[model samples]
Target: MRRLYGHDAVDIEVATDTQRSRVADVLLTHPITQRRVAFEVQYAQLSVAEWRDRHESYVQQGIIDVWLWGHTRIRRARSEYALEPYRLDDVQDELRKAGMRVTFINPESSQLAIAVNRFGRTYSLASEREVDLVAFELESIRLSDQGVRSDAIDPFVTAAREREAALRERELEAQEHAEARAAIEAARAKKASARDLERARAAREQFASMPARVDARSGVVRPSVTMPARVLCRQCGKPLDATLAEFGVHLGPCRWEQERLL
Candidate 1:
């Protein structure tokens, strides 16, 4: 299409409002093959006037073959078998007069076997085997399998599109899962940080509540000395039980104060 295969397969600069043949949704041109394949995808039924108008535009634009992918709607309607039958007849007549060749790629087993729609005064002669997009996608396919058949292009492009779409969907799902995990980890980290803060607060409170003794001699202070927790002095950087306070030295002084005393 113009969006994906613009510079590679399609020519966008060649467009105009008056000509109305400006550009197609997808156009694949091979310089060596001298082949220009164009597509007109139809997701819904096209009335008689719209069908003929579009056919003429494709032919005049020097496109090799035209593919009309009829969307599945009203499965059992006559329009399901053929679209704008009368209009197709008129368009074919005009194209034949202009010596233009047209082929129809209808996605039906019966149509494939017959390969022609000779509706009584209602349609033009066109190959009928439509490209089953879904089956063709799910099935293993090769580009070289169809030798110069325009019909093959429809299915090939369809499969390529479906595969690409599925891959993108999976990638999006994986990204979503990764984002979810990051959010969960962030929340967990915050919870753990809160718990650590609570433990720190409780520790500070217990240390403040515990009784301490300061040795006036060594400037060493000891907390409520215990076997394990708080066994180190809160001040003077000395073991609680081994501090000046435990040694009953009342006139302890740090080096800074000792120098002043000297």
Candidate 2:
């Protein structure tokens, strides 16, 4: 096998004379270091039958990693022999349980699934998404003009994190909805988010009838509208511009004023 794969490791495939000898169909050894590897191949047609027949060959070698490969669909589908150290079906089953879209489809009767979120795109299983965000926020420092750490970095950061944690605890305790942000920019963010959400919902509602475009990444920014831009008209349907000319009061506007706000 080593001769075929052209690895620097040397492979020795041997049969055991004694019943106690651990058997490796292809025992790979690092040429110079003499590191030994006992590789086993089990087909979809034959797995434990093969392993049980070969297990006694490696017992004297102590611990040997078995690489199970080449199994048939009929052979790989059954879990009656599952609790074995290596099985393709176990990996495939767990991936299905995790609700991931990907599965093993190779012809070798091999299935290996490490879930999408578990694939280590970022942090470990213990600290997954936002671990970096939390770490960055925790380590945030405000440098002063004098090249010293500003007082804001200390008390302000600590207070903000404590406040956030407290909010999360309260939200969890109450079994409430998503916790809203409390940052100074939160009000503007909420307004922008609401506008975006409304736009998406409306677009989705009329998507089938909407015209197809070339290249497709185009949008328009809506002008800002706040309570200050509008005043209630007591009589007419026109939007009363907040014109405080006569006195400090916004009386209202007549119908011919053009813009309307009810």
Candidate 3:
């Protein structure tokens, strides 16, 4: 620790001024920023509530606390929903919510390992959902207001953010497509309705223009009525007058059907 930061003011198990007696495992004061950082090596199982309480204590005194969990302690936390062979640490999520950083160091190897969440992809195998731990040197650790900031995790964090942005963009595009389709369908329906209304108006005008005609059956003089007219059939070669137009169907046989009628 003295060789890395050139800080001769490193102390072990130091007490800070607070309402409650707060002891930090290892404390080092930054020479330039005058900021103090406390490093806590957690070997035993610690509950989230207890961890939060301790973290809050340091925060009250304006001290940055960095936590390094024992490998077995961290590995014990497993996700219930995720498949076997890969398990997420629920404690990590809680720590993230408080803007805290976490790392795992085995007693045997004494190497630093960072666990990062995977995003923007599908995981088919159970092992794929497992914790992905990247090993980095302790030299990468830097002190920040948020806690110990490391460049080792920067790539993973950036990738996750990019994936989230891409997903949001895709959703927006899909919504736009649905709205456009609805608009096009409404326009088409409106056009068809207008065309039908124009056709009916023209038919009415053609009927009203005809001269008076005699009724074939009763020999009565019938006045021309301003009603819609329709062609009986293509082969019949005549449109129905006002009285017969209401039927809309061919009453008499056309040349094509005359042979069948006989």
TM-score per prediction, in order, is 0.32, 0.26, 0.54
lDDT of 3 by residue, 1-262 (tens): 6665675757788887654388888888877787899888888777778888888888889998888877775553265664333344555556755545457777576567766554436311112325556767776767666556668766655665566577799999999999999999999999999999999898777766655443333343444444332334333435565576556435656544755766
Which candidate wins on TM-score?
3
Ranking by TM-score: 3, 1, 2
TM-score winner between 1 and 2, please give it: 1
Q: Rate the local accuracy (lDDT) of all candidates.
A: 0.45, 0.37, 0.65
Residue 31 alpha-carbon offset, candidate 2, angstroms: 2.0
lDDT at 29 for candidate 3? 81
User: Better model by lDDT, 1 or 3?
Assistant: 3
Candidate 2 regions exceeding 4 Å error are 1-13, 16-22, 44-59, 71-87, 90-262
lDDT of 2 by residue, 70-143 (tens): 32321222345433222334433332333211111233323322111212233111111111111112122222
User: Judged by lDDT, which candidate is best?
Assistant: 3
Lowest summed lDDT across 10 adjacent residues in model 1 is found at 138-147
Instruction: Write down the lDDT that model 1 would get.
Output: 0.45
